[model samples]
Target: MKVVCSYCHRLLRESPGEAVGVSHGMCPECDAYFAKLWGGLKLGEYLDLLPVPVMVVDGGGRVVAASERLADVLHRPRAELRGLRCGEAMACSRSRLPGGCGKAEHCRECTIRRTVDEVHETGRSVAGARAWVKTDAGRVPVTISARPAQGFVEVTLDEPEALAGALGGHAPPSRR
Candidate 1:
């Protein structure tokens, strides 16, 4: 597989198989430019280069950081998404109950929650985990991959369209 900088279209390298993890790789020149643009390349900058909805969640499943794609998918400002729990941001029906977020029974079976928990607990990367999220319209199926990054876990989604379909062609409602 060929890897290129998603921002500058510079060729990075070619891999024999699929590129794992969150990076699309960056050339040295674009790297230097982005470093100055963002006051040094940050997690968000790397996330912005990804073509999927990805976020960095803390130990408790709170979104400590996210890409603009995640912000757009959730239909919330990037700043507002920072503190929302992963389930809440995705509008998981179980998360709306009194128990909230991770406390509900459905959460026990949630792949995203499980992957996040595993990464936080063991500091290992999880890939190609299929997650079914319950929403108002239907069950949304998505493929997720996660890796421990910095002090937070980097989570990426491969099926935003399936998630959109599950949400009935709309972004999930903002947290209350």
Candidate 2:
């Protein structure tokens, strides 16, 4: 039988010989799921999207691709964020890590971080994620999404300006 990974939620493909009395023909559902999961995460060249900040990681969840938007949301340099640990990149310093976001440690309690973790577990794409981030003014809701990014995970922040624009204020121009 084609099994879904409880850890990553990815579908396990069963060969004809392995299919036997379990699942029927090739599982197209799982195949499609994998496609969307991976495509949505791939970054840089493949898709020309809006200015929303995006962060992509590998299977290990390391930061791989970070767009202009991610840098703004995280309040860090885009160049500095590349190749850093996922936890470190988003959290920045020790102050931003475990218990950095909420009562729970490791940002697991943070909805955006949790969505990314869920996508990693399913090997599937997580979409339309909306989160109320804790900011100086108050809690601000921002939309986001997660997918596989080649060897890493890809996440895009949406409508972040409307809710928490006051957090960072404005973004500088990028030549690229």
Candidate 3:
């Protein structure tokens, strides 16, 4: 079997026999791009080291900081995202209601919000949770994973395409 880079579709390596033995490595070009983008910054200082959009939130879901990728995804400067609630920062449509983020009726079922709450309560990290956000275009599905680190919940957001190849082509729920 041949392992390939998800972003560039370039061959990374080859493996025979056990499928589990296949090494997930990126090609040189993609490696350098990620190295240049994320190298040198320490974890607490920059969640931006991750290729996906990320946010560091407090126990109550307030945004303590965000990654550069997150800023790009939100189309706003990182500074503007600081101090907002997670739902507010991500602009979950439910946030628009009078109750705001956690207080909103729909928030209890929101994977992102629920994951953050669970992490805060149990100090356990969660991975590959599916979540959906109501955007102007429609509902956009995302794979949201989070970990407790440096006194904050570091949440990472991955697009469907990013997870598809890794998850054996089973994509997350699609935008409606």
Among these predictions, the greatest TM-score belongs to 1
Q: What is the TM-score (0 to 1) of candidate 2?
A: 0.54
Total clashing residue pairs per candidate?
Answer: 0, 12, 0
- Give the alpha carbon lDDT tens digit for every residue of 73-132 in model 3: 665688899989887776567888889998988988888899999988888999999887
lDDT winner between 1 and 2, please give it: 1
Candidate 1's displacement at residue 20, Å, is 36
* lDDT by residue (tens digit), candidate 1, 1-176: 67789788777887666865434778898878777777755678777777788899999999988988877776667888888889988878888988889888778888889999999999999999998888887777878899998778999876677676665465433331
Can you give the lDDT of residue 175 in candidate 3?
A: 30
List per-prediction Cα lDDT, in the order shown: 0.81, 0.60, 0.74
lDDT of 1: 0.81
Stretch of 10 with least lDDT, candidate 2: 94-103
lDDT digits (tens) for residues 70-168 of candidate 2: 677677877797776554564423325455432236355566667767787777888888776654555666777888655457777656564436465
Maximum-lDDT candidate: 1
Residue 1 in candidate 2, Cα distance off native in Å = 56
Better structure of 1 and 2 per TM-score: 1
